[model samples]
Target: MEDSTHTGALLVVGAGPGVGMAVARRFGGVPVGLIARDEVRLRAMTETLRLEGRTVASAAADASDPTALRAAIGRIIAELGGIDTACFSPLPPVATIKRAAATDAEDLLTALALVVGGAATTVRAVLPGMLARGSGRLLFTTGSGALHPSPERASPAVYTAAQTAYIDVLRRDLSGRGVAVAHVAVVGPVGADGHRPEDVADALHDLADEGGSTVLHLTEGAR
Candidate 1:
């Protein structure tokens, strides 16, 4: 199916290479707003999309900081007119990864702040506009560790599972409200094996355009 075109703005949080960039490109037909912690990288990505003849804007903020993230989202919304679709895929820091035996409370808390907390903050920031307009799409991407526990990746597993549940509840509450929510679980390493970022982007695009299911699992060999 051809990717549906969006007339309103699309916001990509945790915007960077791989999945984030692929999403931005996939939805480049609309005014694209990007949010990431690295100002330099965000500017570069914005410029890259602009060079492609896309209407692009960017803001720098760490998703873990709610104040910063909200401000960034507001700036993007002001610049792009309003966010009609928002995609969030913030990866937890490497230090947060630890085996179950080696994991501590602090590690789990940090992961929660970055993964679940960040997603919630992003949702809160964009939801008002979506609700006011009576239409919007909230898309999220996480690792399959969300569904299958990984002893070696204890922190991620805990927070991603929480995030998955959060998205599920959001979908349940938002049903018949005109706003769509979907989560995509990536089963393997992106850009390796047969799993590509573009394929994931396509799945996300589908979810945003066609809101049938609340969750989708993107494996290495499947779309």
Candidate 2:
């Protein structure tokens, strides 16, 4: 079911030490572009991948800033030639946990901007090209809290749920248009138990090749 043709750069937003690096490693030979907020870590990741003989480029941008994030994406496209596949995994460790009633408005908005608005902006940047070519892959890494909301993670749950809803609509809107929109929900610690980052990366590649939208749930016991 994997498409043999359609070679283009894989743009990974929120490229960090975990899912981002793992995905790039799984798709080793392809040209890769990484986007993250940390310039030092981004550079180091690029160099690490380059040492493996993988063609890689990196740019740093805050996901909450749409203008900057899109500009960074443009640089990646320019550096890697083109992008046909994109993976978004931007969640960071929660600094402060709050109940829904106690959460601040700005905090909720910030969460939405990073998780939902950020993805929208990135998609808007690359979608035209993909739609023109009639082929592309968009994958988002979602937290399990979205599916199973918890009072402890009230803020993230709200934004992530919104993100999931948005992806659902996007998949429907782009149906039969050759774009694959997928949501991969993380139910537990990414590398804990049998849920290897490598396996998650492999699944993402498979989804890209298949060219359809679907939800994939990964837990400790089930990959």
Candidate 3:
């Protein structure tokens, strides 16, 4: 395992496309750990990184599952020492739009569980060593939901609430703890020309490297 802070192992929890890929590429040349539920996407990203001659690894797991997530993190730590920065962007591709009354209770609960629970899982898995080592970066992605939560889209509204709650927790409790916790809220659709997942990823790692102990509130800085 390589020391992430020292050697630059950026663990991208949701390395699908858009912002996730953008972040991964921005911090080029460092060993990167890409985590995602989709095998194809993970493989594609991993291959791209490897082709570019950068150290890369991939893991398939549901971020909401703490045990599974931790296991994956362990593998990453084993390969890259410890994670210098982690970007948590678990946005589903399809629009999860559901009318308030028609919303599925189970689905909504699961979404909330994954979004918030995964944030906690990812942080907890790495926080211990990061704290002890006295350096790390923890960042999460929030889109339109964080800025303007809609009650009409009940499922998204719920997810947004949880995402915001997690960001607030990071800002309040974890910001100044040697490991800088930052929030990048892409208020619009995040993509290549937009404020995509990769965009958030880049911000996360860059801030982590800066290590200013500042709580970044990037509300759509660049798309």
Local accuracy of candidate 1 as per-residue lDDT tens digits, 61-168: 999888999899989888889788899987656798889999999988888888788899999999988899889999998887766888998887888789888888
Q: What CA root-mean-square deviation does each model show from the true structure? A: 2.3, 2.6, 3.9
**Candidate 1 regions with alpha-carbon error over 4 angstroms:** 1-5, 212-223
- Report the C-alpha lDDT of model 3 over 1-223, residue by residue, as the tens digit: 1234355578888667667777777766678898988898888888987887778878888887889898988888898877777778787423456777877767777777678888889988888888887787777776555456666767776787777776676767765567777765555555544554554555565555543222223354443
**Candidate number with the higher lDDT (2 or 3):** 2
What is the full ranking by TM-score, best candidate first?
Answer: 1, 2, 3
Candidate 1 global TM-score: 0.92
Top candidate on lDDT is: 1
Q: Stretches of candidate 3 above 4 Å error?
A: 1-6, 93-96, 196-223
lDDT tens readout by residue for model 2, 1-223: 2224656878899988878998887766678899999999999999998898878888999988999999999998888876888888885437434787888887788888888888998899899989998888898777767777888778878887888888889889988998998767666667655467765676676676554444445543354
Runs in model 2 with CA error above 4 Å?
A: 1-5, 192-194, 211-223
Error of 1 at 28 (Å): 2.9
